[model samples]
Target: MLGRLDHVALAVPDLDAACERYRSALGARLSPPKDLPDHGVRVVFVELENTRVELLEPLGTGSPIARFLEANPAGGMHHICYEVADLAAARDRLVGEGARILGDGEPKIGAAGKPVLFVNPKDFAGTLIELEEA
Candidate 1:
């Protein structure tokens, strides 16, 4: 089953600018940027007391974040991640309940180095959901 909220991901057109805005305006602490070639994103995590906020910028033209940015232009909340006790079991239960799992219906390694799966946005209202192994 799902555990605590992991991190809220925001797709940004400019990663540096976003990081600066969070740091300067909100006085948020941020981690160094990490390039995830496989995920097609460059990300920086804004440290928060309760949960982290992830700023994502497209790594390449074919990046999913790029597509999201193309649609929104100004960027927006991309997804919200939740930790799950057992990813496989959670996935099975969700599948049985008629929830559509994105990608190949298999868990992929996420930025946290934990197994993660994305549920279809339509299944959980209009917001995309990511479930990561706790």
Candidate 2:
């Protein structure tokens, strides 16, 4: 099952601009941008007292984030991540209960270098949910 709230992600057309705005205007602390080719995203984190905000920009033209930006244009909330102690166990339980897991139902290395998997939006009230191994 879900453990701690990991982070909330937002897809953006420009990572630099978003980071600048979050830093200068919002006075938020941000992490260095990390290119996650496997995930097809250039990512950064806005550090918060309780939780983090993940900013994602497409790493390639074919990236899912690129498609998200094409649809949203101005960018928007992408997904919220929750931590799990045992990713495979959680995945199996969710599957047994009929929840749809995205991407072949396997865990992929995520931003934090931990195993992660995404749940389909339809199964979570239209909100994409990411589960990260804690």
Candidate 3:
């Protein structure tokens, strides 16, 4: 149902600063910022040899990332994404196991323009899990 880790998403208060830190300090390759209005986040992907790191900043006051920052101030790890061959099948399997899916329980277009679904954090031991279609 799950494949390799897709990317680790970090909610950041300042998107540009975060990108600079990864680009200059860590010497990481980063994708240009992309505004995901549907997700209410401005995102940039730090490309790596094995995996990618997604940096998310609030797009609006109502953004979920804004709420997250309100709680953590400095921002922090928001979720971990994993790849799945069949998103609907994986979703069903998770539902059968009583895992709660966030939003409408349907897959939405993700940063990679792939179908993605988010599972409730509580179900995954306080870590939000994102399932992206491979």
Off by over 4 Å in 2: none
lDDT of 3 by residue, 24-50 (tens): 898899999999888799999988899
Question: In candidate 2, which residue pairs get closer than 3 Å at backbone N, Cα or C atoms, i.e. clash?
Answer: none
In candidate 1, which residue ranges exceed 4 Å CA deviation?
none
TM-score, per-candidate, Cα-based: 0.97, 0.95, 0.93
By TM-score, the candidates rank as 1, 2, 3
Which predicted model would earn the best lDDT? 1
Per-residue alpha-carbon lDDT of model 1 for 1-134, expressed as tens digits? 67899999999999999988988999999999999988899999998999999999999669999999889999999999999899999999999999999999999998778999999999999999999999
lDDT-wise, the better of 2 and 3 is 2
Which of candidates 1 and 3 is the stronger one according to lDDT?
A: 1
Q: How many Å off is the CA of 21 in candidate 3?
A: 1.7
